[model samples]
Target: MAADLYPSSPAPSAASQTRFQKLRKRLHKDRALLLLALPGILYFLIYKYLPMFGLVIAFNDYSPFQGFFGSEWVGLGQFRKIFSDTEVLRVIWNTLFISFLQIVFAFPIPIVLALMLNAVRNQLYKRIIQTVVYLPHFLSWVVVIGICVLFLKSEGLINEILKSIGLPAIPFLTDPAYFKPLIVGQVIWKETGWGTIIFLAALAGVNPNLYEAAVMDGANRWRQTWHITLPSIRSTIIILLILRLGSVLDSGFEQIWLMLNPFNKDTGNVLDTFVYFKGIEQSDYSFATAVGLFKGVVGLILVMGANYLAKRFGEEGVY
Candidate 1:
């Protein structure tokens, strides 16, 4: 009765062995490719992952002279300081606010630009437009800010034009209220064309047949775009958005630092600037490390959460 009810155990299949053999064969075939990738692999190990061990300083009252091993351990002490400091909290607020503005306003400009370019029938005009827009991206922040100061300073070109037009001059750079908008505007102007490159590439991959079929079905250009063009690039957009969410706290350090001044410091003080002031100028390495570590942890959590949400929504994520 037992034998009838329970079948005898079958012999183990050689599937595992076969897979191992296949993997070995594939590795041998891709040896040259692996060799080509070796430098990049080493770079991550040496610069990225290996340096992670230094994060231990975040938990201690570290001193450069005392060294890593000799530094007195004050676990979570710096983190406690960060939470208790109103200034730090304010900085966090500024960072989040700027990053939010960027995500909401700056992120979509490239897509819109790409769509407009895609709709253009004249390739020469499109190329000229693209080249002009892309030129700003190559300019360093110092140069960009210099150009901004030249145009946006109180007595600069913009105000001169406004005066000629009998309109009052706007405080584009000096006012705290205008600071964030200025930052977002700068971001859009500098990076929109560069960002469009990726979207334009993705759009190129979208089948022209989809548009042809839509046309045959009596769909207008707007309807074809809404139904066909956008859907085709949906996955690319989602993946990029997920990646953007990962850096939600990283308001550009160089851009903000170059633009930062006493007048707009209240709205412009972000994590990177905070770290620079504390670590470099003030020589408070431990607290600076703690703040940086905290930022990294938050970034990791955000990336993981975004990836999860993306997967849940049936989109391919950056994982």
Candidate 2:
């Protein structure tokens, strides 16, 4: 029994040799593509994966002066404090509300835009419109928000137009009521075009003959879209949706941080803002890291659950 086996003691078996040979052949064939991907692989390894070791700070009562390992280990104490806060409920409510709005109002606009653009038969008009929409996606958050300020402020263009029409200048920036809508609207305007690109690619892969057949069967554009276009891109939609769910809790920091004020603090305080304030502004790194870890864990669970549901429904989900 003692001599029965030790792993890696024996020489490679025939099946193992064949598998190794096949793998070597594949590597040789795909070497050029792998070389092209080398920079991206190194980028992730350096910037993304390597930094995951910093998560240790989440379990410590961390201080920069104390260094990573030198920090006192509190192990979940920070998490407990997070949930124990009386304002935590309000913060959670604000985060969920914004996230929900983004998913419902922002996510689908891309698909709709893609579909509408796809319907345009005039190539020049379509390209022009695409260029116009795509411009916003390239704008930095600071510039984007500045444009919003220029348009939506009390003395801004929008209010000027309203004043000219004998209407009151609405408190769009200061009012809590407008905060969530403004955020959602900003996201929609900035990202909707960029998001549509993927759906358009999926749409391009669709068989044109399907549309022709549908027209032959007396189907209108709407009918063709319903019967062919939407169904063909169903997988893409499912994949994007599953991926979206993974980031549902990550309400952005820079945009919200800029827009957030005493006026809209009740509605605008999201997880990202909370992390910035707690971690950077207040120097409570452990608490902030704990909150971030909590968000990440929830995101992972949501993604896993969504992927499971998609597979159950016979769809190929994002792995």
Candidate 3:
């Protein structure tokens, strides 16, 4: 019995040593690629992970003079303030409404545009259209907002056209009722073409034989797209949808902040702008940090839930 027990010990150690050696060899083989990725790894470690240490400020009465370590802990005091504040609630509602609208309406635009462009037989015309549409995405938000102001202001070109056409001047940008639509429309117009690039790539990956086979079976172009093309790109669609779901809380800051006036604040103020106002403008560091932490947690939960659903449905999700 003693001899048999002693004999098993060396065998286990030898197997462990072999496994370690194999792992070492594999790492050595991929050393160059690992080196190439080191900078990005360090960047996330320093910038992203390191900042998480400051999240403790959310529970403290953080003051520049006191410093993070010297700040007095208040527990959930800041979160309580956020919950009781009606303005913050309004901001949250506005953010959710705009984000929901964008996800619902803006998300499908690129896919539709890609399908339409793919159907076009003329390569030159398709490229021209794509170039024109994609150019807007490269324009700075400031420039885009300036362009919008020129066209949508009370006395601007759109109102002028409406006046000329014997219709009343509609407030496109200034009115509270129109703010959500305007923001959604701007996002769709600016990003749709750039977004289509991925879908187009996915469409290209679709085997031509599938379409040919469908055509031979008396399937029309629309029918072929419905059956073959859409199915081929389903994975890409699900992945993008998961990403969009993750950002369902962030309605952007630059465009809304630049465009919103007192008149449009009800529908224009979002979580980002609210955080800015509370943190930088009012110097309420603790409250702002708490709100931001809340948003981040919600975003993480959304992404995780979406990814889980994607996996459950047998789709390739963001890991």
Query: Among all windows of ten consecutive residues in candidate 2, which has the lowest summed lDDT?
Result: 1-10
Ranking by lDDT: 1, 3, 2
The estimated TM-scores of all candidates read 0.84, 0.82, 0.85
Model 3 spans > 4 angstroms off:
1-46
Candidate 1 wrong stretches, greater than 4 Å: 1-46
Q: Itemize residue pairs with steric clashes in candidate 3.
A: none
Q: Compared with the true structure, what per-residue lDDT tens digits does model 1 show for residues 54-164?
A: 888899998999987689999989999999999999999999999999999999989999999999999999999999989989999998888988999989999999989
True-structure RMSD, every candidate: 10.0, 6.8, 8.3
Where model 2 places Cα greater than 4 Å from the true spot, the runs are: 1-51
lDDT of 1: 0.89
**Residue-by-residue lDDT tens digits, candidate 3, 1-319:** 1222222323436659988677778889999997998778767766786679789899999999999879999999999988899988988888998999999999999999999999999999998999899999999889988998899888999999999999999987766898888888889988999999999999999999988899999999889989999999999998888888888998877988887888987778899988898899999988999999999999999989988988887876769
- Number of colliding residue pairs in each model: 0, 0, 0
Output the worst ten-in-a-row residue range by lDDT, candidate 3. 1-10
Q: Tell me the TM-score of model 1.
A: 0.84
User: What is the TM-score (0 to 1) of candidate 3?
Assistant: 0.85
- Give the alpha-carbon lDDT of every model: 0.89, 0.87, 0.88
